[model samples]
Target: MPEVLVQYQAEIWQAIGETFIMVGVSILAAILIGLPAGTVLFLCRKGQAFENQVVFSVMNLFINVIRSFPFLLLVVFLIPFTRVLIGTAIGTAAATVPLSIIAIAHYSRLVEQALLDVPKGVMEAAISMGASLKELIFKFLYVEARSGLVLGLTTSIISFISYSTIMGVVGGGGIGDFAIRYGYQQFKTDLMVYMIVIMIILVQFIQFSGTTVSRWIDKR
Candidate 1:
């Protein structure tokens, strides 16, 4: 292989590793927080079990507001909190704060929507069968929406990857940061192009794998 090609491959792999780390941490946090928040949102929705407009609206406003902020800006806004949590706000670990926070809001809304997509009759049948809230949650809602949840999770992972790249602005070094630092910032056109191509390929590979697995896991 060409010397430049070999060098690019090494840097590309390194950047990919960082991206994976950020996305992995964010996805775990998103699942932990998003699932419960979504469940609460669904339960509090109008005409559902434990319905409450006040609760639903409050959560709705909060989630929407959190999700609406641009990811890069959110990173800047969360610097203090990130530093407090990670002991520094300019590394792979610190990058996870914004990634995870944004993931929670992003995935929570997706989870809520997925639950809403579950047919109302399914819940009614469960209720008539004398199901408890726990039963409804574990068996009915999630079980029925398992496929959609997978897709939602896939979406969250993709979003997390994109957001993680922006962490470069704050020195949250990753492939993106490497590209910016050595490629664009240094005016190395070839390096910049290589990074862009690798990033695109990585995104494509992730999206393809995620979609295929999600479809396979879907019982329906």
Candidate 2:
């Protein structure tokens, strides 16, 4: 490590941890809630099982509205709700509230698009074989769309990292916040560049891993 890095190793590690916490929670929310929500959106579309225009329209509009907000404004707007839920609108934990909400909205839309890419023939065949909704999802739709799903998650995770960088507005410290404070404000230009390089490496690794896994699992 360079002299500058050696000087701030501990702070750098702590920032990394904070970034992980914020991004990890967002990932969990995306998987647990967003995945199902997207599935519901797909199912409720016209001519699919349990199709209901009202439900579809409501959900579609809600997701669109959430996604439409500029992220910084969204974070500021959600301060009151974040404080209510986390008892403070500042820090790593508090930052997770908005991160998770946006993650769900972001990933849910990608998931719906992924499922939509699944051939219509797959759905018809599943129905012909008397597959239950659960069976249709797990056995057919998900399997066929697994690669797209993985790619979507990969894209979402990258966006989460980008969003986490702005958490400093709420005192939510992460690598980005660390860079802005100790590196930029302190006039440590080299340190800021190093942090940016680290983020680039992290994103590259994630993209590579996600693509490899997607390819490995893809049957089509």
Worst 10 residues of 1 by lDDT: 1-10
TM-score of each: 0.92, 0.98
Cα-based lDDT for every prediction: 0.86, 0.97
Candidate 2 lands at a TM-score of 0.98
User: In candidate 2, where is summed lDDT lowest over 10 consecutive residues?
Assistant: 42-51
Model 1 clash pairs are none
Total clashing pairs in model 1: 0
Q: What's model 1's lDDT at 17?
A: 87
Candidate 2: count of backbone clashes, pairs at least 3 residues apart or interchain: 0
Q: Write the per-residue lDDT of candidate 1 for residues 115-146, one digit (tens) a residue.
A: 99999999999999999999989999999898
Give model 1's TM-score versus the native structure.
0.92
Tens digit of per-residue lDDT, candidate 2, span 1-220: 8999999999999999999999999999999999999999999999887799999999999999999999999999999999999999989999999999999999999999999999999999999999999999999999999999999999999999999999999988999999999999999999999999999999999999999999999988
